[model samples]
Target: MRPILLSGHERALTQVKFSKEGDLIFSVSKDHTVCAWYSANGERFGTYKGHVGALWTVDVDPHTRLLATGGADNTMRLWEVQTGKLLKTWDYLTSIKRVEFSEDGKQLLGVTEKRTGQLSHIVVYDIDSNPEAEQPDEPTLRIIVDELPRVTVAGFSFLSQYIVSGHEDGSVSQWDAKTGELITNVFSHDADMQVTDLQWSADRTYFLTASKDKQAKLHDARSMEVLKTYVADTPLNSAAITPDPQSYVILGGGQAAMDVTTTSARQGKFEARFYHKVFEEEIGRVRGHFGPLNYVAVDPTGKCYCSGGEDGYVRVHHFDPPYFDFKFEVEREAASQSRM
Candidate 1:
């Protein structure tokens, strides 16, 4: 596979996501800017620039016309995708770490962090209402999760019935999206490790969690049972499973920030690694990034995937057709062997 390198961010890239239509890509960075690009050719469209502080996260609505972003400024802002005009802003008492739109684009979810008391909160807002109407004084649902470890990442379920959050202490919690009630919490990893990222499978039957404990695990979404585990030499920062029929798990990570300078640091461990979703076998790896990778996202077509890195660059990789053809053959072979 050949990667198309898109570089413009002056600082580390925080997140990168493809639009629902898979025609556009959005990236946010510590440089305090969010950029839009043509995913097909890696051409720059324009940069949205109103954040006063370094941006931590961004999300595109289901309709792909509105963009929501939050950052160190303790504010969440909505912008029009076509004009890059700031449409609305919500100010909070703390910085926002992550933001996501519900599957139906009716609600917005955000995780806010307060440095003073090291407190965290999950905020949900009604985004589908008339924009011209007066705004409510408070969010639709705001829950203080201060008792649990700091939340690192969160996302809505496929049907938007629940919100799942990964915490710094390697725990996963499910919450009622409508009522802000806690459903259940699972200790996914060792007590000392941190859960860095969580992603639901394309079928929504299972989800994957990447942890600082140097492992990625696949779990049954309903029962929360451990289905499989992929271990690495270094902590995993992010992971994603390709859509059904050709399901493959892609993981990206490397040595922790402080361990990067050590003499024992393993070379090439930062490359993106691929594994068979069913058999849990390492299939291949893609090498390009010089620094640790922060996130990985597969487009809706599953023909290409994107990676954001601490090196301040986003790489879009389009796979050759033969790659998928070979995977299909392998799947058939595995099935035949299992039946015998």
Candidate 2:
């Protein structure tokens, strides 16, 4: 596994996104710089400077070939990927937590902090127009919900035309990506723990939510139902659903197992299980990391994945390799045959 070193001091990496070609990776750091890198060689590409505060999230629109970034500055900026030129600065009255582009790149969807007396809002903006246009129009609609206790918004997924926003309160909502209509709010255990990460399966039929409540859950996107939930030994902050969506890989950092004895500093507990159609069963486990994992992302091919955590290290794991372990076994078998 190759490690890609990144800049940005000791600040938390809020978001990491891959370009359409998957050759370049862009990460927004608490240091307030958007650093791009060549994934293959771990070479630095370029950096974009504009945000005064930490960049909270970033999304790349495939059709327009533009990058949209949201920040703690209560604004969103659009940039040209190749040139790193700032195209536009979008202003909002609230701090933007999550920003996403539509399937066609004609619109932008976001969730923001609730302002005074205002409930949480899901907003939609037309990309072709501007907030400061000659005849500016307000964002299409606002869906106000019970305010989120935490200011952080986990992430959003665009399943078909519906937008799923996972909040810090362990609640997931389905919204009309175009109209901002509230479809359904999915509730599993009513734990009220924060949902730190979320992802929709490749087929968009089911989605996964990882929470600090010590569980990773799967929900039916169409019905907003909790199909299954896996309990972890410790608080789970991050998880990933494989492309197949039949299994899930979850990170508990230093979560202790049922048989764990000593509390070593080693965060050596990671688990991947095959759930869903198999009635939610545990399939595999690994004690892979030496520190609590901060994030886990599966590549497009589903043949490999990456993880980064509090240890300030990133590691890549190959799921499939045709020639792995040939040397040791071959030598052992040759010795045994010779002795025979």
Candidate 3:
């Protein structure tokens, strides 16, 4: 299979997000730039340059043309996607690790690094009414509450009622979206290894989490119980659960550059792994990226999956009939068009 090469940037990419149409790729780089590129031709769509320090993450709203970016500079800025204009900026005074758009796109959720022993807080911003633009005294809903650890909150999801966060403490917590109340914390693993990433299934019934413990865990979102676990060779940095909620593909290896250490050189090539839910085992692993893995997302349909890593490469992978019998029609079209 021929691989489509997206031009590498000067600095390492911190995060990548795809538009709802699956046509464009949004990337946040340590070079302090947020860039949008055509996933097909690798064409540059637009760039936002308001971040003062290394851009840590970028999230796009599904329904509206809005973008949220967080940086090492301890700020989260909201942008108008069409004009690339900065709408508002919130200062947190700590490194902002991840930012996510609520499912309905009405609110923005941000998780910041914890310096002191104080519990980490998830800040919710109301973007609906820009009362600050009209009435300076208008209240902006900023809630500070205890969270799992201030470690990398690599993944987050919000349904119509609740918001869920996956944290470095190897746990996933559900909270009330409207009141910011803690509902429950689901402990999937015994160790404190970072739960690097997570994604909810289409119906919001189940979610998947990847951890530094070299495992990907599936949990029942409703009961908060561990459903299954897939053992990996190295640390699993990020993962994306398929739309079906039955399976998921994980980006294995931490988000660090690969080097030929005596111990690791004897190991093997680093790559991503795919697990089958029904069989409850790892059926396939793709050794495409040479560097440590960063992120993985299965297109809305369950067919094809995309991964980006520290090698500054984004690879879109395709599977044949036995593994994936065209379960995801939308992703199949993308894979067909790109010849992935």
Question: Tens digits of per-residue lDDT for model 2 on 16-89?
Answer: 66554556666675667777766666567787889888777777774435778888888878777777877777
lDDT of every predicted structure (CA atoms): 0.83, 0.61, 0.68
Query: Could you tell me which residue pairs clash in candidate 3?
Result: none
Output the number of the lDDT-best candidate: 1
- Tens digits of lDDT, candidate 1, 109-155: 88997467758899888885334444444689988897788888888
TM-score of structure candidate 2: 0.76
Candidate 3 versus the native: TM-score? 0.83
Compute each candidate's TM-score over C-alphas.
Answer: 0.92, 0.76, 0.83
Error of 1 at 192 (Å): 2.1
In lDDT terms, how accurate is model 2? 0.61
Runs in model 3 deviating more than 4 A are 117-119, 129-148, 154-158, 244-247, 254-269, 301-304, 318-323, 326-340
TM-score rank order: 1, 3, 2
Model 3 worst lDDT window (10 residues):
130-139
Backbone clashes in model 2: 1
Give candidate 1's root-mean-square deviation (CA, Å).
2.7
